[model samples]
Target: MTRLLEILISLAIVAVLFTVVGFILPSSRHLEHSVETNRKMPIVFDTLNSVRRFKDWNPSVAGDPNIKLNLSGPESGVGAKISWDSEEKALGQGSWTISKSEPGKLIAYAIEDVDRGHDKSSEFTFTPTGKGGRNIQITQAYDVNYGMNLLGRYSGLYVTSNIGEKMKLGLASLSNMLATIPNLDYTVLGKDDPALAPKLADRAGENLLVLNAAVPLNQITIQTQMKTNIEWIKKNIAANGLEAVGPVRIITNEYGSSIYSFDVAQQVRKAGTDATVKLEGLKLANNVELLYNEPGKTAVVAFKGHMSNLQNVRDALRAWAMTRGYETIDRPYEAWKNGIDPGFAPGQEGEYDVVWAIK
Candidate 1:
């Protein structure tokens, strides 16, 4: 009877200890991790603002290749969401929705997990660091409320090994991804105006009369060559029973210090049918060829500047495309908004739609 009584007292004491410790534990948990990168603010912010590229840099995705993911809501900023289902017990099922976005500053997400319950959030804040603020320091923070749940408070003890470790891996992955993108500042092309930012667009396939030429890097020389090419194209268009359908396009093949090599192209179509004529039967002039530009995606930007500046704008467009994880597939080109004659006039400032084919 004495032995039985001692055993009962020891059991009661152990239960009391567990309860006391559970009550003493905090009901809330916060985890933070940071990483630094030389990438620009916009590049880092854009990556986190949209769930479109979530699978690319997310460590969790890499850990579970079989995880299925779905994207919903807007493509970027607040309301963008990504949901995932994984066979792995650790991942289970969950969704992350962008709850707040401050361009170049911060992005916050509301996280939901079947096993973790609710009232969980994560955020990424950006701060300019290093010389001339060229480098960026990114801090990721996670917060969870356990309320009165003792089990959850105890689970918080492992949060560092679980959630904290993931954040560090994720930020490292993000830095590596950013390294692949071009570091050029695209805003220089638009003079810092968001309205003039480079944008992705679709280009329909079209039949073009193309004339390739190499000319001395002089405005007058370039203009003369283009004019000669356009006249030849006009004659061919008339003979082929086709009409010029769009402004002249200049595809830059090479822009050397002393020489410029380019293709002068014009879209053409049958007058009433709006369809291009077959190239096989068409009569061609010297140095001119019929081409069918295949339909594809492109990065485009509007620029009002001299022809000499077009090359710089093309570079900027390419940088912008790279930052968005796009690959360039063809040479850059420009559609002259103003007629070729006036666009090449001395001291003339012309408007053009600079385009770079990308995939």
Candidate 2:
């Protein structure tokens, strides 16, 4: 009887100790820290715009060089996501998406943290701290149930020590990226224009092309094999008086040529019914052809080069055309200048062109 009483008393003492320890440990939800740093507003905003560029500054990226990551969307500026997988538990699985953006002000993100036995949504704010300067604040907060509260507390300690150091490094790297982007006096092009309205034509030219059953318009569409962002092309086309005519369609000719046929009919209805015209391939060699015809009084200048280096040639052609009183009427074409299988490296010689019409 005496031994049994002593055992009961020991059990009560152990229970009391457990309760005290539980009371002392704080809840996981309360264990978070915020990190902030200041940078140029423009630079900060641009760096946070895209998660793909984070590889250049992310602390985890440096630790795991072999980690494989997949990125999606426009690569930058809102709705973009970056995800990665790793054998290292510390860097296992996670993804971040740009949740919000305000040009020069701020960009916030939502983070899905997996592999840490938790989920988190974090926000990074880019606030204008001074004239042309920005203050960036990043807060990582999460919810943890009672069972995992201890783990969360431990994470807080490491975050202030290691994670804090890495995050600061990332911010510094972003600062450098911003420094490289030159600030021009000009504003972003076409900020006031209607989203889809074509600019008014300043110069009048008949330049009409018609398609019939015998000879269809050789609508050609060639995309850069390296996944080109055709934004510049879109802006150029809109900036000029060139208007679209119809539903965009990709057609393959019997000759194994691919053509992107835009409904010029739709464009004609708006610009003028009689403005449609056509041209024939006056010259063809190695799959590169020259389509020339007098659609109107306007002059058309066209050339071809590699897809990767097409921008350079196009720029040069634009300068040449402008000097000679010409403007672009179409989003230029790649005429297969190098042939079906050209032996050249990427950014090497390929079938591309810069075509323009002169007044």
The CA lDDT of each predicted structure is 0.84, 0.44
Per-candidate TM-scores read 0.83, 0.43
lDDT of 2 by residue, 1-359 (tens): 99999999999998787666655655443233444545334345555677756676556556677888888877567788888887777788777777777786556666665423244444555444434444555443333333445545544445545555655666666455444433321122223533311122232432222221112322122333111212332232344344444322111222222333321111222234344354232222222211223443322223333343444444444333332224445543333434423313444454332343444
Superposed model 2: Cα runs more than 4 Å off: 1-43, 114-117, 131-148, 185-187, 194-359
Error of 2 at 201 (Å): 22
Question: How many steric overlaps does candidate 2 have?
Answer: 25
Q: Which stretches of candidate 1 lie over 4 Å from their true place?
A: 1-16, 114-117, 187-197, 214-225, 254-261, 276-280, 294-297, 321-328, 341-346
Candidate 2: Cα lDDT at 350: 45
Check candidate 1 and list the clashing pairs: none
TM-score of candidate 1 against the unseen true structure: 0.83
